[model samples]
Target chain A: MNASITPITMPKFGLAMTEGKLAGWMVRPGATVRAGDDLADIETSKITNAYESPAAGVLRRQVAQEGEMLAVGALIGVLADADTSDADIDAFIAQFNAEFSAGAAEEADDTPPEPSVMDVKGRSLRVLDIGHGEGDPIVLIHGFGGDIGNWLFNHAALATGRRVIAFDLPGHGGSTKDVGPGSLEFFSSVVVDLLDTLGIDRAHLVAHSLGGAVALTTVKNAPSRVTSLALVAPAGLGPDINMEFIDGFITADRQKTLIPVLSYLVHDKGLIGRKMADDVLRYKRLDGAVDALRQVAAANFTDGRQTDNLRPVLETAPPTLIIWGKDDEILPSSHAANLPDAITVEILPDTGHMPQMERSEEVNTKIRAFLAH
Target chain B: MSKKSYRQAINEALRLEMRRDPRVIIMGEDVAGGQGGTSGVVDAWGGVLGVTKGLYTEFGPERVLDTPITEASYIGAAAGAAATGLRPVAELMFVDFVGCCLDQIMNQAAKFRYMFGGKARTPLVIRAMFGAGFNAAAQHSQALYPLFTHIPGLKVVIPSSPYEAKGLLIEAIRDDDPVIFLEHKVMYDDEEDVPDESYTIPFGEANLTREGDDVTIVAFGRMVKLANEAADKLERQGISCTVIDPRTTSPLDRDTILDCVADTGRLVIVDESSPRCNMAADVSALVAEEAFDALKAPIRRVIPPHTPVPFASVLEALYLPDAAKIEAAVKAVMNHKVTEAA
Candidate 1:
């Protein structure tokens, strides 16, 4: 019941995460803290990441031990003004625990978000639209072998102020696997049609890897629809690509084989965790995913090289920002060097092909700043 | 494009196929585990052996479906889905689990095209972990491809290594006919250089792993591994033997088998399945009928006795045919002299 006291809870890494283990605590009790500072290390099924302090205060108490597991949003530690009493902190902890447990129970009754499949132009596509209020919406298009959940870390973060939309491209996720010709144009048309179905006039398009090509194609085909473009380590602008990575990704079937292939996506091989690899394998197990990927692979990267070049289209488009991983192994970082000076380019160091995943915080910051302009 | 385990190869094939076709879906118990649990975790277990890991996250639940333990409904749904608009790769989990959903696979998926007067393409792939090893006991292990090979409408694929696994699986995914893709549990970790591109190995072409003029040895699935082992041991003893991997059982490369039989004038078939009505019996029948005049010795079959796979390691080892049994069979075939010194 202390007004100055606040609780530091176990943070949710992504939408799918419900619980996280306290891998380690970064700050000790009584230490001064600031919002956004690394407070603790939380390990989720997908990856281990540092939990940031939500508010600035003094670290009053460590309620959860380093090794204990807590539900997402459950109290892991306590923070308060230096003047707050120990008794008040204890009472606050007890009250917070009770409230947290009650809230979790209430949430247990709430239904999980159900992804809807829409018949967009005769092809089935899976879409997840989160958040509702005004402003032009932001649409997320994932790269090759990626689905809507690839934005699990970014979607909700960006949705706080406006509606954010993410969908599985045809042949990638829950979308109709039959991608006609499996070309960027085919995917770009689907994105525009999806916007039409949702009644959106103009929106900011954020795309990664192959999705980057789709977004660029969308801008070229229907310039009025795309308000802004955020391309991350995109494909169409590049000439050189690691066809070995693409081919390995499409062909690998088992864990021993896939683990090494997936390791190429991130600078930290550890980021290519068991769950991430398993997720890809599960997608590949789907009946039509293999054939769809093959068509896409052939259309996009024929004979181990990129087939499309959209630098000219992108050079003339509305405000654009190109983000590349300095250590991107899948698509070489050199591709980002050839961009027009008008196109703002940010090459993140110590990152890999999946800078959006490996260095999400920095990437998010760049994206936010670009969109603000 | 380097050495990969048999497990890695199969996983690669599934990964590639799923990436290629959006209509292609994967369904099985725990294939993408943690469905409807209190933890709110999805994709908990990729597969019993971790084969389906990483897919649920990449493709999401709708495409990489994690079905309930009830095999009949899902397997039948797979068949239904395939016939309608999807290419469903339903994992039966294990070959032994086939008992729970054989009707869907055999009666529905295997019969649709023919019953429909050749107007359908049931591009359904039923992937099941097969063979015995790891002391998994009776319920978890069984090499049941023989049951599928007997059916007329089904195409049976049994890949020997990682390279074969990727190519054959891609082929199965692309084929219009219903295919039963069997992965030997024991061979999953066995590595070989597998290509990264989407390429397929044509069915019915027997891969001659080793060639020799002394005797011809044909094997299936795990037996092929044993045959290679036996061939290697025999080579040291000055008795070289040819080892052939008949990758597909239904389209049993009878021509290849007969040609080898005629050239060597002696035959030995190593089949892990129980003796009666198996690939061994099938090959033996082909040689007996077609190459009756060229036979210099009676055909020898190294197979497990007609009994349930035992649980104990010692008993299981005895129950399963090994390189020793294969070597003995080859020697027996080679030792025969047509006229006893004529």
Candidate 2:
């Protein structure tokens, strides 16, 4: 096989997908494509997601036809040099399929790491500990009603050579649903307890949305325990927030009602797919899930506004960097404004509140650079 | 995002709900062991198989209550507590013990809302371990879901995997009506990637584990896994099958089952319970009555004999509807030649 020939296979969207249908191909068989190009629409039980091209090449034989259901990692199309012969492509396809099945057999025998539940101050917390290195450990904190899965795209990217841990706060994910007070102090304390449980004295904090407030409070209480802060579209910097999104997120139980509500969190409304809404609804249906979310909303987002203000923390906070989506609808990008002149703020355009998810590649690059320094 | 055993998944659901709502409480015999012991150590055992382990430690004694072996009194108290505002999750250690508390569940809790003309709500969940495999023998290992399915105003849930267990258990707790959540004792150690977040799989929706064109295999709970295994093995020999897991029995997903049968024109049911008047029989009747025209072959039911679940491992293996039996049933239905009625 030539080094230039690349096999474009089915991509796994979320943790739950086992197989998906090749809904359609974006480019024709002979069309030239580049890396990161939208190659095809892969439809799974959860959502219809666009499969991106992995490499730049002339689209060769479409091994798997459109509308065909294929398992994860199954070859859907082949990308090869225009000069490659038709006979060679056929031989390569056979060899690749054989090797792919062999690899799958080995994977079936391997045991992958799973997320674990941790007992922190009596609350059952879900933690995802990934990577290992000599640098100060990094902790990823999700926003309100968000779990460590929110960092799905960026977790492994930033954990290249350092230990990175992400956890779901109380009332979120597999954590205990009780959100006592749901205040910045309560959340910050939980973060501190988790860090202490992990035996980390000081670490870089990468927090998003409501987690931004918790990070601010943690630095205010025990500034020594934090090495640095990377806040992404974080709360606590301003008072104005999209209450519509908050209330809609709390009340929207079905997919139809939720898609519009979640649209406020992204620049592209199309990103609010059925699967995303279904996932959120499923969480809300859990016993006491809605009530706990109500407490958090009332405590933090009272009177149609953010309840906490940690602008002062920005003055004395350890080397902090702020990344905000220029089109953030949940928290205004203006919060990124009026910040200390020394703090480096990157307001990404054509993105929304969930820049970490919408433009994960760019967001991860900024975060990795911030952490390295 | 991680692998969690069926035991851990259920424990997480109970703990999350208990913490989220002060009204949610857990009661069962030795759910929290070490009650009134000479050592004075609290939370001695968390269920007979430790499925509820660590819950008592987190929720403490007030929320995680331990009851005596008397099933009637505790189960009645749970029903009462649920009616009076508390969302109680009472454990009936083994499903066989339901005979001791059937009145509280069937006649009282299940009928409260309807009897009161929709004024009353009983957000109660009775979780019990069912199915045979463990040496627990005949009395302790009964797949008694059909008994509860016979009752009205009651939701019957039979979770197929760790993911289903967590989601469906949470849904049962949040539901306003009485829910009978049955767990397979043999599946406690079965692990799968369950989301750390609390999620609920809606009731009455059947999950198609595998979609095929040749035959349709409808099964419930542990049998769903077996059907999937059979389908995989059959696919290798050019015979394909679709496996369905009707997550809830009462709000049974008739549409999914009928649609699959209609598509394939062949049906095979694998039920773990006794042969007489079982889920397999019920489903077979449903298809015979409703989708008869769509059928190209007679429906085949792979079930154990009406005899009690045997004690010996060999007998138990023979008595259960396994992958091999399901495969044979599918082949039989596939090979069946339809004859005109004489």
Which candidate wins on DockQ?
Answer: 2
- How many pairs in model 1 have backbone atoms within 3 A of each other, for residues 3 or more apart or on separate chains, i.e. clashes? 50
B1-342 in candidate 2: lDDT tens per residue?
A: 578999999998888888778999999988885554687866656667887787888888888888888999999999989999999999998999999989988889999999899999999999999999887799988999998998998999999999999989988999999999999999999998777667788899777778789999999899999999999889767787989899999999898899889999999998888888889999999999999999999999999899999999999998899999999999999899878789
lDDT of 1 by residue, B1-342 (tens): 357777767777778788878887888888774554787876676577878777888888788887878999999998888889888888988889888888988888899999999998798899998887668888876789899999999999998878778878888888888899999888777886554545677788787777677899999988888899999889767687778899999788788788888888889998888789988999989999999998989999998888877889898999898999999989998888678664
**lDDT, each prediction:** 0.84, 0.87
The regions of model 1 sitting more than 4 angstroms off are A28-32, A81-85, A365-369, B1-342
RMSD of 1: 17.7
Give one digit per residue, the lDDT tens place, for model 2 in A1-373.
7677898998866444567888789989989999889898887765465677889999998998876778789999999989998888898899989998988887774443457888987888888898999989999999987887788767878888999999889888778888898898999999999999999999999999999899999999989999999999999988898988889999886555788998888886766765677678767776568898999999999898999899999998899999999999999999988888879999999889998877776788898888877
Please report the candidate that would top lDDT against the real structure: 2
- Where does the lowest 10-residue lDDT sum fall in candidate 1 chain A? A109-118
DockQ of each: 0.03, 0.21
